[model samples]
Target: MPTQPKVIFFDVNETLLDLQPVKESVANALNGRKELVPLWFTTLLQYSLVATVGDRYADFGDIGAATLRMVAEKNHITLSQEAAEAALKPIRSLPPHPEVPAALRRLQRAGFRLFTLTNGGSAALQDQIGHAGLEPYFENLLSVESIGKFKPHRDVYNWAADEVGASPKDCLLVAAHGWDVAGAAWAGMQTAFIARPGQALYPLAGPTTYTCEDLSSLADRLVD
Candidate 1:
């Protein structure tokens, strides 16, 4: 029989909430340069990692607004700071993906402690789950702000396990991002990769304990 995790750590962004709506926001902010949506997002994540490596800490939301301004400037799109902030505001209200609510409840019912660890800060994460009406399902919401680093950093994963009084080996990280799964696996935690559309597992990462099409699929494996 397979071992069950004592705790499950979820990733908040694309893993739980649908980011597709933000794509439209980005496209609009870029002056109809819809194609820059992906690039803008990539830049945001890249800069977040940069801060982590430089021994500096910045909230993901701050970095997001900054990066949006940078992306606009780079493309000579003439975006204003106000417009960028407005564009990013939609994140606060993003809905959970179709399968997320049921999947989370399933995991919760399985005798596992469920929590979130994200690059997003506490206030942002709380507001997000609250907006999606998901706060009830999660026992706690964690953020990387404490360590001043983002996900995929080994310390972040270990910190999460330590914070909740769980051993790394007994925790399973479920995320849509390959890099997050890779980091958790490297830290000796179990991992489930949610293959959300264009997202793919990293070829060089350690094998995932579960690879499913969505959160529901992974919950199915864990619940029954």
Candidate 2:
């Protein structure tokens, strides 16, 4: 394993916050077809990368709404952007995962600097963290909005490291998403993959420094 990093940057959605509530809200909007939530989410991620590659910058929420509309259209359902945004409203107030608070405490007590890095807009990110009462656990919240590019883009990772005044190798990215982990790993940062439900590593990506089932397990391994 790589030595412990000086700064540990976390991916907010799904990694720290439980997305079940948001999923439920989306399910309601999709006429109870809850199975489609994953597809919508994956499409959101895919198009965020598309936006990045196409030199277009849009808020994560906007991309989410657009993807939801696409998903709706594909299924012969109609969804307006405004309505889709309303459905995704739960995202701003998502609760942290059950083990998240305690795991963060453990990591803080172990003297590692913690911060959040996300593709979500800064205003919405602040609301999410504040609503979840996770503000005190992080030193700062970083957003790709400022960079105009999304995760899995090498530039975003590099910019994040520079923004925090840390060498890429001295930073550790903690995320549940395969693409996020891959991006950070390729950018020369250490990575810890939190295997949240339905999450998996990209088979083609290089190995991560650590892989654990949850934040608590990751904390245990980190502080051991």
Q: What TM-score would every model get versus the actual structure?
A: 0.97, 0.97
lDDT of 1 at 109: 85
Residue range 135-170, candidate 1, lDDT tens digits: 989888999988889989999999999999999999
Query: How much is 197 displaced in model 1, in angstroms?
Result: 1.0
Q: Give lDDT tens digits, candidate 2, residues 148-186.
A: 999989998899999989999999999999999999999
Could you tell me which residue pairs clash in candidate 2?
A: none
